[model samples]
Target: MKHRWLLWFCLLLPWTAMASTVQATLDRNDVHLGETVTLNLRISDAMTASTPDLSALDHDFEVLGTSTSSSLSVINGKQSAELIIGVALRPKHQGDLQIPSLTVGGSQTNPLTLHVEAPDTSASTHTGQDVFVEAQASADHVYLGQQILYTVRLFYAGDLDGGSLPNPDVNGAELKQLGNDINYEAVRDGHRYHVVERRYALTPHHAGSLVVPSIEFQGEMLDRGNPNDPGGFFNPGGLFGNTTPVTADSPEVKIDVQAPPASWGQTTWLPARSLTLSLQGLPGDNKLTAGQPLNLRLSVDAQGVSGDALPALSLPTIDGATVYPDQPKTSTHDDGEWLTGHSERGFAIIPQRAGTLTIPEITLTWFDVQSGQKKIASIPSHTLTVLAANGAPAPAATTSPSAVATSPAVASSAATPAIAQVAPAASSPTPWRWIALGSIALWLLSTAVFAWLYSKRKRAQASVTKPRIEPTDSTRTLRQAFLESARGDDRAIQGRRLLAWARAERPGLRNLGQVADALASDEQRAAIVTLQREQYAGVSAETRMDLAATFAKGFAWQQDNQAGTESPLPPLYPFKLD
Candidate 1:
C-alpha cells in the first residue's frame, strides 16, 4: 500500500505544477498612436513576488509605469493565490504591435496583439513647446442666433502640480461649456505630450463681428532634475524648489455673424445643424379599446441649440379622444462638439367612443445651417382602430338572404293576417280617442303643478341668502391643513396649504409668491419665500425653516388704506374672462 501511494503522489505532482500557469490580457486591443494602454500579467497558483520581464516590449512600445498586486481565494475547499502585474505602455509607432510572451516565476504568459492608429496631424504645430495652448472655432461665419463650437487644447510635456483655466469671454454671444474636459496623450515632433481639451458652445446674439477673448492658463509644474545633484534635497539656497510657474494663452478668435435673411418670414428663427420629431409609445398593432388610455411621448431633438431655445411641443384636439398632457421636459447634451437639445412631452389619450381615431401629423420648421436652407421635421399622422369597451356584448347575428327567401311564402301569409287584424283594431277609434284624451289631460295637470312648484321654489330661494362659512372658520380649516402638511416632508403640499390659508385672509392671493407679498411681517414673508424656493427650486431632505412654528399665531394682514376710496370714473364692466 505504501509503494502504490508513492506512485500516485509522483503522478499528481506533475499535474499540480502544470496547473500553476501565467496568463496575459490587455485592457484595450485597439488604440491610437501616442495613447497609453494597460497590460495585465496574471500568475495563478504561483507565490513568487518577482516582477515579470517586460524588456521585449521596449522595441515597439514605451513603458510608462507599473504596479503589482496579489490576492488569495478559496473555491470548492481548495485554496489558491494569484499575482497580477499591470504595465502601462504607449505605442512608439502606428500599426499592429505584438506583445511578446513574458516569463515570471518560471511560468510564461501568452502573447497579445494591439492595433494603433496615427495621431492627428493638426497637433504638429505646437511641436517643441514645453507648455502651450490653442483655440479653434467650428465656423468662421454664422447667422445670428446660430451656435458655434469653440475648442481649447492645452498641451504640457511634464507633470502639472496645479492649474486654472478660465472660460473665454465673447462679446455679443452666449457661451457655455459643452462637457467635461478630456485628457489624452499626443505626439508632437517625435515628442509625447499630455493634452487637456475643453469645448464650448457660443451662440451669437447680435449680428456683426464677434471676438472671443483669449483663454489663459495659470499653474505650476513639477521639475524633477537629476537626483545626483547635491542641492536636490534640503536646498537652503532656494535653487531647487522643484516647482516652476507656467502660463499659456490661446489666440483670440473672430467670427462674422450675419443677420437673418429678409425672405425669412415672421417665424421663430431656429438655425440648427439637424432637427427631428418623433412620436413613441404607440401600440404596435394600432388597435385600441374604447375608454382605454394610451400613453404617448412626443419629442423634438435639435443639434446646435439649447433646450430653452426650442419651442414647446403640443398635440391638437383629437376628435374621438380626450388628451391629458403632462408638463414638458427639456434638456441639453454636450458631446464635446455641439450642443444637442431635447424636448419631450407626455400625453394620456382616452378613447371616448368606438370608432377610428386619427392623430394629425406634427410638423416643425427650422433653418438648416449646414445646407443653408429651410427644413421641416415632421411626424406622420397615426390612425388607430378603436374596438368596443371590454365586456361589451357582441352584435346580434343577421339572417342570410337565402334563409329569408326560403320562408318568404309562409312569412307573407303570416304578415298579411297580422296586418288585417291590426287594421280592424285601428278602425275602432272610440276606445283609442278616450285613451288619448286622458293622456292629454294628465300631461296638462302635471305641467301646471310643475310650474307652480318651480315658481314657489324660486321665490323661497330669493328670500333666503346663500349659505357661506364665516371667514374665521374657513381660515381655521386652512390653517389646520397647512400645519398638517408642514409636519410632513412634502414641501409642495405645504406651499399649497399655506397659500390656501393666506387666501382666506387675502382673497386675491394666487400663489405663495402672492402670499409673501401680502404678508405684513418680514419674518413671515421670509419664511414663505424660503418655502416657495424649496418647493419650486428643489426639495432637500431637511426643511430649511420650521413652517409650523413660524405661522403658529396665524398670518399678519397688510393693511388696506384705500379700502373705502371711490373711483373718479365709472367702474368698468365686471367681466370674468377665464
Candidate 2:
C-alpha cells in the first residue's frame, strides 16, 4: 500500500506544479472619468475552459473591448506558456473604483483599485442622466452684421448607433455649421459620457432682439451590455442587443443685436472684434522700372465677421501707375472659437512713366466689439522710385547747352579739329586745298565723336536690360538644384529649391500657391498645384508630377498688360480713428 501511494504522489506532483496562477494588473491606476483603463489578466502555466467572468464590473465600469493573446517560451530548457486577457474599461462614475476579482479557468484573479477624476467644468455641462445636450454662445450682445459663434454639445453614455442634430434657426440671421462634428469624452455629475460637439457661425442681418431656436438631437442608442458576453450570461439577446431611441435638446439662446452706432455715420458698417489690413508683394527695395508690373496684394483680415460682410478692397489710383485688379478672393474659417474672415485682392501696378510712384495709405474703419470703440486698420503710404523702361536714369527736364560744351571729351575733340585746321593752313601754300582738307577732317572728326557717344549710351542701356533676359549664375544653380531634388523623393528639398529658384524671378513670391498664380503656362501651373497637393494634402502616387519634365523649358511668367490711361478712381480712404 505504501508503494502504491508513492506512485500516485509522483504522478500528482507534476499536475500540482502545472496548476494555473491568475494575476490581475491595470495599465493605469489613475485616469479621468471618461478615459479608459486597461485591465490585464495573466494566466500562467494553464489553459482555460472558458473566458473570465467580468459581470461584477458592470456597476462601476463599462467594458469597451476585450482581446486575448497567448505565447509560449522556453528558458533554461524549461517550457512555459502564458495567456493574457486584456479588457478596456471606462469608469462609469468618478472617484475610487474597484475592479472586482474575476474567475478565469477555475482560478480567481486579484482585484485592483483605480481612481477616476472629474471632467473640466468649463468644457463639460451634464446632468445625472443617460443623455443630454447643452448650448452656449460667444456673446450675449453683438452688433448687426457681426458674427456670433454658437456651440452645441451632446453627451451620452450608451453606444450611439445613429443620430441627427439639426442646425438652429435664428430670426433675421444667417446660421451655418463651421466644421464637422467633434467626438470626445467628458464627465459631468460624476458620470462619464461620450460628447459630440458642433459649432456654427451666426450673423444677424437686422438689428433687434434675435432668438436662436433650440437644436434637437434624436438618435438610437445601442445597449451593448458586457461586450464579452460569455455564454450569453450577461446579455441573453446574444452579441447585439436592442437599441433604444433617445432624444436631446439644447436651450434657446437670446442675443441683443444692436445697429451701427450713431457716431459711425455715412460709412460702411463694419463690425468686428478686430481688423487688420496688409499689403504684400511690394519690392524690398521699393524700386521698379516703367513697364514692369509690381504685383500687389491687398488683404483684409477680420475677426467676428464673415468675408461677405466686408467691403471690397481695391487699390487706389496711383499717380504714375495703372492698377489692374485680379479676381477677388474671400473666405471664412473657424478656429474652434472665433470666425475669421479674409478678403484678398491682387493688383498689378504698372508704372506708366518714370517718376516717383506714391501708393496712398489705405485705411479701413471697423467697430471694435471688445473695446466698444471705433478702430482703424491701415497700410501706411508707400513711396517707390521708378526708373526708365530700360532701367536707365530719367532724362533731365532741361539740358544746359553750356554744360555739354564744357564737357572734357567734347572740348578735347573740338580743340583737336581746330589745331589740325590751323596746322594744315600754316604748312601748305594752296590755301583753298588746305582749307577744304581741314574742313573735311573737322567734319569727319565731329561725326566720329557723335557716333562714339551714341554707342556708349546704347551700351549702358543694353547692360541694364540684359539681366531681365539672362539668368544669373545663382539662378541657374538654384534651378539645377531644384531639378535634381525633384528627380528624387525628397519633397522638402524639392520645395526649398523650387522656391529659391522662383524667388530669383519674383522676389515677393512666398509660397507654392503664389508661384502657381505667377506662372503663365497651364502645364506649369498644374504641376505646381500637384506638387503643392502632394506636399500638403497627401495625394496619391498616381497624382505625382514629373517636375523636371514639366518645367524643363523653364517658367513662363504672367504678362501684365499696360493700361493706356491712369485709373480715375479716388484714393483709398486714409481716415484715422483715434
Candidate 3:
C-alpha cells in the first residue's frame, strides 16, 4: 500500500506544478508624491480566467489607464497560458497605500503595499511655480556599465508658448536621448497639467560619482490663473496677457557608479536589465562545401541600454576559414520609459578546404540591474562538416589563405597590394644577344652627340617662374558657390551649399547633423545647431553664420582629424600565427 501511494504521488507531481497560479505585482513598492505606479494582476494557466475587478483600487488610488496582454507557452508536452492586466494608478493623497488582494479563477493574490512621499519644492528662484522643470533618475546608485534612465519633465498648468531645453551632460558617462519628446497629460495634486518629458539612457564606463548637471529651459510662459498658485493667480493667459521669458533649471542628479563584480575581471562589459544574442546562418544543417560561402546575421539586442553600448561581435581569423564583415548597423528605440537597442553584424563565412571546423560559442555576461546579480546570454557553438567542392581547384597559398568566393566588389574594395616584376628567364649566351648590345651602344652614342649639339643651340629657358599656391578646382568651385549662397537671402539654398561642401570633404557624411557631431569644437556644433534651428525652426532670423569662418574651421579640422575618414575594419576570426 505504501509503495502504491508513493508511486501515485510521484505521478501527480507534474500535474501539481502545471496547475494555474495567480499573483499581484508592482513595478515599485515605493513612489513619490504625484508619481504614478503600475500595478499588474498576472495569472498563469489562465485561459478561461476573467479580468479581476480592480474597482477595489478606487478606494485608495485613481486609475489612470489600463491594458491587458495574454501569452502562451509549452513545456514538457504541457501547454500553459498567462493573462496580464496592467493598471496605472495615481494616489488620491500622499502616505501609505495598500493594493487589496485580487481573486481570479478561484485563486487569490496577496495584497501589496506602496509608500508615497511629497515632491520637494525648494531652492528655486522662479517667477511662477505653475510652470517648472524637474529631472529624475531611476536609481542614484548603480554598477559600472549599468544603464539608468535619466529623464527631465516639464510640468505646466499654464500656457507654454515656446522653449528650448538643452541636452544633459554627465561626466564619466554617456547620456543620449532615448527618443523624441513625449507629451502627455497627468493629474497631480488634484490638478490636471500637461507634461513634456525627455528621457535619456546613461551608461557609465568609469567607476565613480557620475554627476548629471542641471538642464536649463528658456521660454515664454502664458499666465493661467491658479487658485493655489500665488504668483499666477493675478495674471491670466491671453494674447496680451502676462507673457514672461522664464529661465528654469531641472534638479541635479548624482549617480554612485561602482565597478563591475570581482568575478567579472576583464571581459566585454555589458550591463543591462535584459540582453540577448542571436545568430542566423544559411545552410541550417551546418554543412559546408569548399569555396561555398555562408551568409550570417548576428544581432545583439539589449534593454535599458543604447545600441552603441553593445559592441559588434566577430570571430577571430581561422586557419581554414575566411570571414568578410560588412558595416555594422545600430539603432535604438524607446518603449515608454525603457529603451531597447538593436545592433546587427553581417558576415560572409567562406571555407577554404574540406575539414570539420568549429565556430566557437559566444557568451555575454551582464549584470542584471533588477536582480543585482550577473546573468549570462550565449550562442551555442556550431560544428560544420565541409566537403570538397565538385571540381574546385585547390587553394594556392596556405600561409595567406584564399579569398572569399563572394562578390568581387568586396574584394576590389580591399587595398590593391603592390606586385613585384619578374625578370626574363636566363638562357645560354648567343651571338644574337651580342649583336643587340652593339646596336644599343651605337644608338646611345648618337643620342649623346645630338644632346650636346641641342644644349649649345638652345638656352634652356628665358627665366624660372615662381610656383603659386593655387586652390584646387573643387576648392575654387566650392568657395564661389558658398559665397554666393551666403550673400543670398534663402537659407535653404545656403544649407544645400554647405552640405555640398561638407560632402566634398567627407563623402560618407549623410547630412549636416552628422557633420556637426563629427566636429571637435563646441563652437562649431553650436553654429550648426543655430543654422539648423533657423532653417527648420521657421522663426525670425537672428544670428549670422560666417561661411568663410566655417570653411576655414572645417578645413583645419579635416587636416588634423582622421576620424572622419575611417576605413572598413578587418574580420575577427581566431587562429594562431606561427
lDDT of each: 0.82, 0.82, 0.73
Residue 44 Cα positional deviation in candidate 1, in Å, after optimal superposition: 23
The better candidate by TM-score, 1 or 3, is 1
- Model 2 weakest 10-residue run by lDDT: 558-567
For lDDT, the strongest prediction is 1
Clashes of each: 0, 0, 7
Worst 10 residues of 3 by lDDT: 417-426
RMSD of each: 23.2, 29.1, 31.0
- Please write out the lDDT profile of model 1 over residues 1-578, one tens digit for every residue: 99999999999997676577788988656667777777988888765558777789999999988888889888999888888888889899989999988887777888899999877667676776789998998899999989988889898998888999999877789999876776657677788888787888999999999999988899998776545663534764444558899999898999999998998898788999999889999899888888989999999999999998999889988987999999999999976578899999999999887767899888888999999998888888999888889735334434433444456565865655555655544578577669978998999999999999999998887556433335697789999999989889898788788888887877777878777766688889989877877878875756588889989998875555322246688769667678
**Candidates arranged by lDDT, highest first:** 1, 2, 3
- The predicted structure with the larger lDDT, 2 or 3, is 2
Cα TM-score per model:
0.49, 0.47, 0.44
Q: What is the lDDT of residue 314 in candidate 3?
A: 75
lDDT of 2 by residue, 84-160 (tens): 98888888888999888898887888878999887556534445568888888889988888887788888888788
Query: Mind sharing the TM-score for model 1?
Result: 0.49
| Candidate 3 vs. true structure, TM-score | 0.44
lDDT (0-100) at residue 1 of candidate 2? 100
Count of backbone collisions within predicted model 3: 7
Candidate 3 colliding pairs: 315-572, 315-573, 316-572, 316-573, 316-574, 317-573, 317-574
Could you give candidate 3's per-residue lDDT for residues 1-578 as a string of tens digits? Answer: 99999999999998688687888877656556666777878888765556678899898888988788999888999787998887888888788899888877678898899998775343234334667787888899998877788878887776887889899877788877876776555555565566787878778879988888998889898654444543433453333455778777887888899987788877677778888889887577767888888888988889887887787777655557888998999998866567788999899888877767677777777778888877887887888878779743334432221233233544543423311111121233355568878998999999999999887655543123223234568866876787677777687887788778767766778988987876777777776787787788865655766655765534433222344355477547556678
